[model samples]
Target: MKPLCLSLLIPAVLFAGATVYNAPAGVEQDKLFQVKVAGQPSFVYSLPVGGMTYFSYTSFARRADIEITVARPVETVAIRPTSYGIRPVINGNVITFRLDRTAQISVEINGDIKHPLLLFANPPESAPPKPGPSGIHYFGAGQVHNVGRITVTSGQLVYIAGGAIVRGSIFMDQARGVHILGRGVLDGSLYKKGESRMIEVNRSSDVDIEGIIVTNSKHWTVPITASDKVTLHNVKLVSDNDWDDGVDVVGSTNVTVDQCFIRTKDDCVAVKAGVQYFTKFNAQRDVSNVVIKRSVLWNGAWGNGLEIGFETRAASIRGVRFLDNDLIHVEGPEGTFSIHNGDRAVISDVIYDNCRVEDSKGLLVDFKILKSRYSKDAERGQIRNIVFRRIRVDQAEMPSILQGFDATHQVGGVVFEDVKTGGRKWTSLADAGIKATHTENVSFK
Candidate 1:
């Protein structure tokens, strides 16, 4: 995909407009198209090659009208998560649409997935916190701060204001009651891959991270290991490098991720037990009570959309829920709802409720308990008591796999209720593009 000329950004830099918020002043803009929101200019961020441009705004649930003029001739336009049923009107190289509520959608022009535009419409933030509080670290708007690493302790707060860009990674190790709240950007573009994770929480408790954009992570975007009672809301993750998973909850409990947008080359969100972190931190605990709901995910070529593991060395991984998440795009060799248990954990009580898949070039569902290269245990694991309810797939072209290691280590007690693929309700494994092997008690309702 050819990048548009950068000269179009010269006029955009001087515009006085009704922006949703102040953007970082020095970042490069995507000039493939000119965007206007409510008759004012809105900036679209240009990422590296093979990545897409993204524009985000806050609307407070009010109707927002957006206009985009393409730099080239337009033939067709499509908006997704098709579940939203948004149809735009295009006139001469220009596109227009209205959104009544908050959504994260992809605007694909001329059916070009390679150069699509990701539009993130956000809800209004209620009472954004300010500076000068005790134990509070605040970075102001529109400035680029070159802080490399932020080591947060217990009972601390790090607030990144909108338009502020912090070139750093945050680590909360062996801490409690830490809050990382912001609308600003946490950029890891300066670091090489494997150098840092954008935000890492190890052996922490009672943590709240919300409304921040973590982009270009050197490694995993956010990895919560051996943590408890963590909440991540309205977060946006954008990274396309290898191993740049959006969020990984390894051996964590009582974690809730709500209303976020994640686009990555690796898994959008993954759950694991006893998985080794990059450092020698806490890696000994069960994975339970992890909930990911009301989020938007775009998985690139390397990993699953919502995965359980290829690393489960703990005793069990239980009570994980995926509710009302829209997987907008998944391009992979992995499945959309996958549980790849390679270790000795007895993974159970997992459910996917009201999940929708818009476009997937891979399998729709995959549950396998087999050893892979990521396995660390001598004994294989099992997957049981899993449910998929009200899952609707719009476009999926691959067959799902349900396989177990052997007779003793199996995948059992699985049920799919009210599941639909390609606009057809399925009651059989073949109808849902599923193939089972060495499994037990799998049924559709």
Candidate 2:
């Protein structure tokens, strides 16, 4: 697939320190679109249309009315998957829309569904401060601050103000009471893959990251490892490289990810019990009490929409919840709700409630306790007490799967209540087209 060739006609809109980006020369354009939020300009990139089964760069907006201007005469404009309930009012080439919360929307012009624009609208932040030393490391607006590999210590607050593009990554290790707050862009374009993450919280606690836009990460965008009481709110992460996950919570507890927009080339959000990279600190920890609510997850080349444990080295992982979220687009062989517990951990007490899956090229649900290539232990894990309540799939190509490793490690206590596919209620395992093997106490209500 090739990128669309277009041009930006408008100059940069500068208002109160916010600057919208103009597409540079020699860069190809797609539809020549421009996005503005609260009279401030945002940078839009021209990405390949549906290249590697994922959409292009996603633009962001605050809670105000958003205006999108495409450089073409539109015959018709519509937002897809229909579940977002966004009614865009079109006047010529400009389309106007507003969102009450965060959303991942595909804007189609003239019925060109393959080259649709990806837009994400986020809620505004309350009580944003000026660039001053209130115990905050503030980056002022309209300037490209090049700080490489910022190491945040304990009781530090890093604030990147609006319109400021900070070109670096943040590393927080063994820190406490850390806060990363702002409406700025943290670009990891200068770093190499596996060199750094956009925001890495390792062995930290009581950390808060809110109202930021992270782009062009070389590795996993935001990886929280061995952390507790971590809260990520109103954050937007967009990446176009391999292994660029939206957020990977590994061996963490009491974590909450709310109202965020994540578009990555890998898993949108993955909960794992110690992978190979962070084996030292995470090998003995379990992931528990995690909640991801009211967010948008879009996968690019590979991986699941919301996944758990392909590298299970801990003892147990439980009490995970995915509530009131949207799985907009998932490609490849993974499912919208997937659990590949390949290690010796006992995984249970997980729930997927009120999730609306728009279009998945893989399975709707996939739960398996098998030994994969990433597994270290010969003994497989047990999976039980899992529930999927009120999950609606608009389009799916494959059926669900629930399989155990062997007779010793079985899957039990799985239930699906009021699950729907293509607007039809699923009353039984056969009605939902699920393949169950070596499982017991599986019910559909």
Candidate 3:
């Protein structure tokens, strides 16, 4: 429990196939963690979380070693999303680990959850956007811009260069083929509660958002509603506030959220079929074909990690997939993977495949067809054909339930396949402590 004071300077080594970005001018560095990737300084941005949380990101074509110098002597070192099994070599105040592929992990020194450091080892990006366009809005590096609520339309590219910080929100309505790219930071701390969403996509199509850090979102971080063909790739959202849901795919279709890091106060990723979306346009009310894959998520104190509805007002909500993601910390009152079908929707064909949980304080699975504060229909709904495959948990023994309002609004055709909790593979329903009252064909395989 003693603080270790060491020189901040370490000889920089130019390791092949690695790129470490420096902090922008006037951006404060993390006092607790000085991270070096491939022997180069990876600027760790410190933010006030529970007390403080540090974040550092680097890109690698193949592999790299991450070295961290801590301010305090560590008794225990835990690198989590424990399904990765990343065991670090700790020597005094230095911790070292190797990453072979793209990963986002929490480094907890002596099991300190409140002050953990988040490391994002990312894959190499595609070629930078070619410099030739009329619809290009660029913010250069080492600068801070205050552009509040920038609007975009068709065939536009909004690029935020590395080491740039922008205090604004990207609002797109009735847009098509718009891309918001590059490695920068979008800080929304200036926006008060209910003022704005960091990236608001309403009535848009063919939109792509890639490689940016969204911090302190006033409302939902990225809310996609009445949109189609949208993709969110390698975006990091680190904002914990009231009602600050990470990625709310509401009434959207053909959307893919890939390889993102979301540590927020509300649901990390939620799918729904009802929302008012924006001011001018009429919103879509049926949701389908949404995929969220290969992301690292943490839900803090408010909602679920991966959730569907309570706002399921549409007639059909189907074809939603959550694949190969990691939920590191889910501390909420609801289920980590839940379906709260409050309205009159037939929610079906949902799949959670190869998901991992490092530390969870919520239900593993909850599929209920009932009413809540967000419901609109007087009659209840049903959940059908839900599959949870290869789920791995490394923490507390969470409970699960599949109940309904009555026999008319029951849960049906659910399968729990290859789920392991605390190193024990579930062979029976008792191993997972699931209660299926009005459920049908619930099986463990």
Candidate 4:
């Protein structure tokens, strides 16, 4: 097979914070392609062909109308995984597409899987909200702000501009009323393993994080621990390393995570009552009232698409909700929706509603209250009152598993309503290919 070859050409624009890249010199100039979004030129980079059998990369634009002009004429062009239902208007080699909202999608040329374009449509940039009477730390666009480790104080605002790249990590410890807002990029590529998370909020209250793209994180992309009333909105995280979870909420209450896009190598989103980092702070308190909704999650490796607890240590975790989300790809043994309650926390009142899972290489759903090697506690947790409603899966290879450790700590009061697989309504547990072991009060509708 011939080596896949493609070139990109980005026009120079006057946008202050737009990303820019220089094409390599060896490729034919005629093979170059240009992409324009919302009248502004965006920086496009080739995604590395990793262990996967394809080539892709990350690109960003703030505009809804995207125009791509490829150098060579194409016989056929289509978007892969077809579940996204994106159709581009092909005029010769020039393609025009419109996006109503921001998304991460792949573009294939001539039915070729060897080389494809992974495009990330970012939301339009707005002026960073004023810091108000409180202090404001701002980083404008078209610049690289090297902040090794930033710690925000109470009642402060840290704003990153749309084109600016903040190379470092952000920390909020023991703070209240902190706001982190931007359309910019927080890049953790420079951070080594175990250094720090791309963003860490600990012991904070009434915090808000919005409209930021985080890339190449060495550790967890975002970890909010021991924080209450925290809200994350319209944030996008892309990671290619191990343990690079998109967003991890641990030992927190009243947390709302919405309108985000996460493509990572680990769990896209994980909710835990307590972990090693916040065990002391979450000793007696429970994690409750957390909602993750209207987000897109893609797991690269070694994790669940949406998971709750393997290291849970708190007394209880309640009122957790995952709603109106799209799990595009889950590439691990762990299922698309997983609840592995390993510790002593009583996990209850959890709901997964209106979720659309496109592809899961493993199981569709796995819920178990059992002890694992990763658990610090010897006793398993109790999982009850869990509901999966209007959940749809396009493809799943393995059967779902719902098991409890024993009768004492069994999974109970579980219901799957209006669940569908491959356009077939799953009215029974067997139809859903779910294996229930040592569980009680399981119902399907």
* Among all candidates shown, the one with the greatest lDDT: 1
TM-score of each: 0.92, 0.86, 0.92, 0.84
Global CA lDDT computed for model 1 = 0.82
Which residues of candidate 2, in runs, are more than 4 Å off? 1-31, 36-65, 73-76, 98-104, 110-116, 130-135
The TM-score leader among the candidates is 1
- Model 3 RMSD in angstroms: 4.0
lDDT tens per residue, model 3, 1-445: 0113323332122357576655555556667898877677777776655222222333444677788899999889988777788889999999998878777778888888888887776565566665557788887665667898889989999887666678899988889999999877788877999789999998899999988878888798999988999999989898878889999988889999999989999999989876664445555478889999988999999989999987887888899999999888898878899999998889999999999988788788887888788887887888999998998888647798888779888899998898888878777677778887888888889
Residues 14-86 of candidate 4: C-alpha lDDT, one tens digit per residue: 3432333222222222223567665454444433311111011123433356677776687787763355677
State which candidate, 2 or 3, has the greater lDDT. Answer: 3
lDDT of 1 by residue, 1-445 (tens): 1223333222212222223544555667766867777676666777652223323344343566889888879999988877787889999999999877777777888878777777766555567777788888898876678899999999999998766778899998889999898767788988887888889999999999988878887698999999999999988898889899999999989999998989899999999878776858658589889999999999999899999998898999999999999998899878899999988999999999999998887878888988899888999988999999999887644588999889998889999899887777778877777789999998999
lDDT scores for all predictions?
Answer: 0.82, 0.77, 0.81, 0.74
Q: List the residue pairs that clash in candidate 4.
A: 17-142, 17-163, 47-56, 47-57
TM-score result, candidate 4: 0.84
- Taking every candidate in turn, the Cα RMSD to the unseen true structure, in Å, is 3.3, 5.0, 4.0, 5.9
Tell me the TM-score of model 2.
0.86
Clashing pairs in 3: none
Best-to-worst ranking by TM-score: 1, 3, 2, 4
Candidate 4 Cα lDDT to native? 0.74
